[model samples]
Target: MLKGIPKIISPELMKVLLEMGHGDEIVLADGNFPAASCASRLIRCDGHGIIELLDAILKFFPLDTYSENPVSLMQVVEGDPATPTIWKDYRSAIKKYDQDFTSFEMVERFAFYERSKKAFAIVATGESALYANILLKKGVVVE
Candidate 1:
Protein backbone atom coordinates (compact mmCIF):
# COMPACT_ATOMS: atom_id res chain seq x y z
CA MET A 1 0.00 0.00 0.00
CA LEU A 2 3.02 2.25 0.13
CA LYS A 3 3.73 4.77 -2.61
CA GLY A 4 6.83 4.29 -4.79
CA ILE A 5 7.40 0.80 -3.50
CA PRO A 6 7.20 -2.53 -5.32
CA LYS A 7 4.00 -4.37 -4.58
CA ILE A 8 5.98 -7.60 -4.32
CA ILE A 9 7.67 -6.36 -1.14
CA SER A 10 5.47 -6.97 1.87
CA PRO A 11 5.32 -4.43 4.69
CA GLU A 12 7.52 -6.62 6.85
CA LEU A 13 10.18 -6.95 4.15
CA MET A 14 10.14 -3.22 3.59
CA LYS A 15 10.62 -2.58 7.28
CA VAL A 16 13.58 -4.96 7.50
CA LEU A 17 15.25 -3.65 4.36
CA LEU A 18 14.81 -0.08 5.55
CA GLU A 19 15.95 -0.68 9.08
CA MET A 20 19.07 -2.68 8.21
CA GLY A 21 22.32 -0.75 8.71
CA HIS A 22 25.71 -0.83 7.08
CA GLY A 23 27.47 -4.22 7.40
CA ASP A 24 24.11 -6.00 7.63
CA GLU A 25 23.54 -8.71 5.05
CA ILE A 26 20.19 -9.80 3.61
CA VAL A 27 19.59 -13.04 1.82
CA LEU A 28 17.26 -13.33 -1.13
CA ALA A 29 16.91 -17.04 -1.20
CA ASP A 30 15.38 -19.77 -3.30
CA GLY A 31 12.36 -21.82 -2.30
CA ASN A 32 14.51 -24.69 -1.04
CA PHE A 33 16.06 -22.67 1.76
CA PRO A 34 15.16 -23.54 5.34
CA ALA A 35 13.97 -20.02 6.02
CA ALA A 36 12.51 -20.45 9.46
CA SER A 37 15.51 -22.31 10.75
CA CYS A 38 18.08 -19.87 9.37
CA ALA A 39 16.43 -16.49 9.37
CA SER A 40 16.58 -14.16 12.36
CA ARG A 41 13.63 -12.56 10.58
CA LEU A 42 11.85 -14.13 7.63
CA ILE A 43 9.97 -12.30 4.93
CA ARG A 44 8.18 -14.44 2.41
CA CYS A 45 7.42 -13.11 -1.03
CA ASP A 46 5.68 -16.21 -2.25
CA GLY A 47 4.40 -15.19 -5.65
CA HIS A 48 7.46 -13.25 -6.68
CA GLY A 49 10.67 -14.67 -8.12
CA ILE A 50 14.16 -13.64 -7.00
CA ILE A 51 14.64 -11.27 -9.95
CA GLU A 52 11.49 -9.38 -9.13
CA LEU A 53 12.46 -9.08 -5.51
CA LEU A 54 15.96 -7.94 -6.43
CA ASP A 55 14.57 -5.33 -8.80
CA ALA A 56 12.36 -3.97 -6.07
CA ILE A 57 15.05 -3.88 -3.41
CA LEU A 58 17.67 -2.29 -5.64
CA LYS A 59 15.26 0.49 -6.38
CA PHE A 60 15.88 1.83 -2.89
CA PHE A 61 18.93 0.15 -1.40
CA PRO A 62 22.39 0.72 -2.73
CA LEU A 63 24.94 -2.13 -2.81
CA ASP A 64 27.66 -1.78 -0.19
CA THR A 65 30.85 -0.35 -1.64
CA TYR A 66 32.74 -1.18 1.52
CA SER A 67 32.70 -4.95 1.20
CA GLU A 68 34.35 -7.08 -1.45
CA ASN A 69 31.49 -9.49 -1.18
CA PRO A 70 28.76 -6.95 -1.65
CA VAL A 71 27.06 -9.63 -3.69
CA SER A 72 27.66 -13.34 -3.38
CA LEU A 73 26.22 -16.41 -5.08
CA MET A 74 26.42 -20.15 -4.51
CA GLN A 75 29.00 -21.69 -6.80
CA VAL A 76 28.19 -24.40 -9.25
CA VAL A 77 29.48 -27.80 -8.15
CA GLU A 78 33.13 -28.59 -8.86
CA GLY A 79 34.70 -26.33 -11.50
CA ASP A 80 31.49 -25.61 -13.32
CA PRO A 81 32.08 -21.96 -14.12
CA ALA A 82 29.07 -21.85 -16.39
CA THR A 83 26.75 -19.40 -14.63
CA PRO A 84 23.27 -20.58 -14.08
CA THR A 85 20.50 -19.17 -16.27
CA ILE A 86 19.01 -17.42 -13.27
CA TRP A 87 22.35 -15.75 -12.58
CA LYS A 88 22.49 -14.52 -16.17
CA ASP A 89 19.13 -12.86 -15.64
CA TYR A 90 20.44 -11.27 -12.47
CA ARG A 91 23.47 -9.94 -14.29
CA SER A 92 21.29 -8.49 -17.02
CA ALA A 93 19.07 -6.85 -14.43
CA ILE A 94 22.06 -5.27 -12.77
CA LYS A 95 23.21 -3.94 -16.11
CA LYS A 96 19.74 -2.60 -16.83
CA TYR A 97 19.75 -0.68 -13.56
CA ASP A 98 23.11 0.88 -14.57
CA GLN A 99 24.63 -0.27 -11.34
CA ASP A 100 28.38 -0.29 -10.95
CA PHE A 101 28.11 -3.86 -9.74
CA THR A 102 29.30 -6.13 -12.50
CA SER A 103 30.45 -9.35 -10.89
CA PHE A 104 29.10 -11.79 -8.33
CA GLU A 105 31.67 -13.83 -6.46
CA MET A 106 31.02 -17.51 -5.98
CA VAL A 107 31.12 -19.20 -2.60
CA GLU A 108 31.05 -22.84 -1.58
CA ARG A 109 27.58 -24.12 -0.76
CA PHE A 110 28.39 -24.56 2.91
CA ALA A 111 30.06 -21.19 3.01
CA PHE A 112 26.88 -19.66 1.65
CA TYR A 113 24.93 -21.28 4.45
CA GLU A 114 27.40 -19.96 7.00
CA ARG A 115 27.05 -16.46 5.53
CA SER A 116 23.28 -16.74 5.59
CA LYS A 117 23.44 -17.63 9.26
CA LYS A 118 24.90 -14.21 9.93
CA ALA A 119 22.38 -12.31 7.83
CA PHE A 120 20.05 -9.83 9.54
CA ALA A 121 17.10 -11.31 7.69
CA ILE A 122 16.29 -13.67 4.85
CA VAL A 123 13.73 -12.86 2.18
CA ALA A 124 12.57 -16.17 0.79
CA THR A 125 11.30 -15.99 -2.76
CA GLY A 126 9.32 -18.58 -4.67
CA GLU A 127 11.92 -18.93 -7.36
CA SER A 128 12.19 -22.55 -8.43
CA ALA A 129 15.42 -22.12 -10.35
CA LEU A 130 18.55 -23.77 -9.02
CA TYR A 131 21.26 -21.57 -7.56
CA ALA A 132 18.94 -18.57 -7.39
CA ASN A 133 20.12 -17.56 -3.94
CA ILE A 134 21.93 -14.26 -3.52
CA LEU A 135 23.18 -12.26 -0.56
CA LEU A 136 23.18 -8.49 -0.50
CA LYS A 137 24.99 -6.15 1.85
CA LYS A 138 23.32 -2.95 2.91
CA GLY A 139 25.08 0.34 2.18
CA VAL A 140 24.74 3.75 3.72
CA VAL A 141 23.26 6.59 1.73
CA VAL A 142 25.83 9.34 1.86
CA GLU A 143 24.50 12.84 1.76
Candidate 2:
Protein backbone atom coordinates (compact mmCIF):
# COMPACT_ATOMS: atom_id res chain seq x y z
CA MET A 1 0.00 0.00 0.00
CA LEU A 2 1.20 3.52 -0.79
CA LYS A 3 1.58 6.14 1.90
CA GLY A 4 -1.46 8.41 2.41
CA ILE A 5 -3.56 6.42 -0.01
CA PRO A 6 -6.91 5.04 1.09
CA LYS A 7 -6.91 1.25 0.99
CA ILE A 8 -10.40 1.24 -0.47
CA ILE A 9 -9.01 2.85 -3.62
CA SER A 10 -7.97 -0.05 -5.80
CA PRO A 11 -5.12 0.09 -8.33
CA GLU A 12 -7.55 0.49 -11.20
CA LEU A 13 -9.36 3.32 -9.47
CA MET A 14 -6.02 4.94 -8.65
CA LYS A 15 -4.95 4.84 -12.27
CA VAL A 16 -8.24 6.34 -13.46
CA LEU A 17 -8.13 9.12 -10.90
CA LEU A 18 -4.55 9.96 -11.80
CA GLU A 19 -5.33 10.04 -15.50
CA MET A 20 -8.39 12.26 -15.14
CA GLY A 21 -7.88 15.97 -15.87
CA HIS A 22 -9.22 18.98 -14.09
CA GLY A 23 -13.05 19.28 -14.33
CA ASP A 24 -13.46 15.59 -15.12
CA GLU A 25 -16.28 14.10 -13.11
CA ILE A 26 -16.48 10.80 -11.26
CA VAL A 27 -19.59 9.09 -10.00
CA LEU A 28 -19.77 7.36 -6.65
CA ALA A 29 -22.97 5.38 -7.07
CA ASP A 30 -25.02 2.78 -5.29
CA GLY A 31 -25.59 -0.78 -6.43
CA ASN A 32 -28.82 0.07 -8.24
CA PHE A 33 -26.92 2.34 -10.63
CA PRO A 34 -26.46 1.11 -14.21
CA ALA A 35 -22.70 1.32 -13.88
CA ALA A 36 -21.75 -1.51 -16.19
CA SER A 37 -23.27 0.17 -19.22
CA CYS A 38 -22.56 3.78 -18.25
CA ALA A 39 -19.03 3.68 -16.93
CA SER A 40 -15.94 4.26 -19.04
CA ARG A 41 -14.07 2.63 -16.16
CA LEU A 42 -15.79 0.93 -13.21
CA ILE A 43 -14.42 0.22 -9.75
CA ARG A 44 -16.33 -2.26 -7.63
CA CYS A 45 -16.49 -1.08 -4.05
CA ASP A 46 -18.72 -3.94 -3.04
CA GLY A 47 -19.81 -4.09 0.63
CA HIS A 48 -18.91 -0.41 1.12
CA GLY A 49 -21.61 2.24 1.34
CA ILE A 50 -21.68 5.67 -0.30
CA ILE A 51 -20.40 7.71 2.62
CA GLU A 52 -17.56 5.32 3.32
CA LEU A 53 -16.33 5.39 -0.25
CA LEU A 54 -16.79 9.15 -0.55
CA ASP A 55 -14.86 9.74 2.66
CA ALA A 56 -11.97 7.71 1.33
CA ILE A 57 -11.86 9.58 -1.97
CA LEU A 58 -12.02 13.03 -0.40
CA LYS A 59 -8.77 12.24 1.35
CA PHE A 60 -6.95 12.61 -1.94
CA PHE A 61 -9.05 14.69 -4.32
CA PRO A 62 -10.17 18.26 -3.84
CA LEU A 63 -13.40 19.60 -5.33
CA ASP A 64 -12.99 21.85 -8.35
CA THR A 65 -12.89 25.47 -7.23
CA TYR A 66 -13.77 26.82 -10.67
CA SER A 67 -17.26 25.33 -10.72
CA GLU A 68 -20.35 26.68 -9.05
CA ASN A 69 -21.39 23.19 -7.92
CA PRO A 70 -18.48 20.81 -7.80
CA VAL A 71 -20.74 18.22 -6.29
CA SER A 72 -24.10 17.11 -7.66
CA LEU A 73 -26.69 14.60 -6.55
CA MET A 74 -29.87 13.13 -7.98
CA GLN A 75 -32.84 15.07 -6.65
CA VAL A 76 -35.87 13.37 -5.18
CA VAL A 77 -38.77 13.39 -7.67
CA GLU A 78 -40.97 15.61 -5.53
CA GLY A 79 -38.76 18.64 -4.91
CA ASP A 80 -38.68 20.07 -1.45
CA PRO A 81 -36.68 22.74 0.35
CA ALA A 82 -35.28 20.27 2.88
CA THR A 83 -32.04 18.62 1.87
CA PRO A 84 -32.21 14.92 1.12
CA THR A 85 -30.80 12.67 3.87
CA ILE A 86 -28.09 11.30 1.59
CA TRP A 87 -27.06 14.79 0.59
CA LYS A 88 -26.86 15.74 4.24
CA ASP A 89 -24.35 12.97 4.92
CA TYR A 90 -22.38 13.89 1.82
CA ARG A 91 -22.15 17.49 2.98
CA SER A 92 -20.81 16.48 6.34
CA ALA A 93 -18.23 14.14 4.90
CA ILE A 94 -16.98 16.70 2.43
CA LYS A 95 -16.81 19.42 5.06
CA LYS A 96 -14.63 17.22 7.23
CA TYR A 97 -11.82 18.05 4.80
CA ASP A 98 -12.77 21.50 3.58
CA GLN A 99 -15.24 23.37 5.74
CA ASP A 100 -15.40 26.39 3.45
CA PHE A 101 -17.30 24.44 0.81
CA THR A 102 -21.04 24.36 1.36
CA SER A 103 -22.47 24.41 -2.12
CA PHE A 104 -24.44 21.46 -3.45
CA GLU A 105 -26.94 21.17 -6.27
CA MET A 106 -29.36 18.52 -7.43
CA VAL A 107 -30.37 17.51 -10.91
CA GLU A 108 -33.27 15.47 -12.27
CA ARG A 109 -32.70 11.71 -12.05
CA PHE A 110 -32.39 11.20 -15.80
CA ALA A 111 -30.23 14.28 -16.18
CA PHE A 112 -27.91 13.04 -13.45
CA TYR A 113 -27.65 9.73 -15.27
CA GLU A 114 -26.75 11.49 -18.49
CA ARG A 115 -24.06 13.40 -16.65
CA SER A 116 -22.68 10.27 -15.04
CA LYS A 117 -22.46 8.64 -18.45
CA LYS A 118 -19.84 11.20 -19.38
CA ALA A 119 -17.87 10.95 -16.14
CA PHE A 120 -14.23 9.92 -16.07
CA ALA A 121 -15.22 6.86 -14.11
CA ILE A 122 -17.95 5.44 -11.88
CA VAL A 123 -17.40 3.79 -8.53
CA ALA A 124 -20.20 1.35 -7.80
CA THR A 125 -20.77 1.01 -4.09
CA GLY A 126 -22.95 -1.48 -2.25
CA GLU A 127 -25.10 1.15 -0.58
CA SER A 128 -28.77 0.14 -0.45
CA ALA A 129 -30.20 3.58 0.23
CA LEU A 130 -32.31 5.20 -2.48
CA TYR A 131 -30.64 8.13 -4.26
CA ALA A 132 -27.32 7.46 -2.56
CA ASN A 133 -25.27 8.73 -5.46
CA ILE A 134 -22.95 11.70 -5.99
CA LEU A 135 -20.77 13.11 -8.76
CA LEU A 136 -17.52 14.91 -7.99
CA LYS A 137 -15.59 17.19 -10.32
CA LYS A 138 -11.82 16.84 -9.97
CA GLY A 139 -9.82 20.01 -9.37
CA VAL A 140 -6.32 20.89 -10.47
CA VAL A 141 -3.36 20.58 -8.12
CA VAL A 142 -2.34 24.19 -8.18
CA GLU A 143 1.17 24.91 -7.05
lDDT of 1 by residue, 19-129 (tens): 999989999999987777888888888868999888888888777888876888988778766557998888887666536776998989888988898899998888998
Model 2: lDDT of residue 44:
88
lDDT of 2 at 100: 72
Tens-digit lDDT string for candidate 2 (1-143): 78888888888888888888999999999888898888878888899888978898888788898998889988877755544477778899999977878788788989998998899999998998888889999998865
lDDT of 2: 0.86
lDDT of each: 0.84, 0.86
Pairs that collide, model 2: none
The top-ranked prediction according to lDDT is 2
Clashing residue pairs, backbone N/CA/C < 3 A, model 1: none
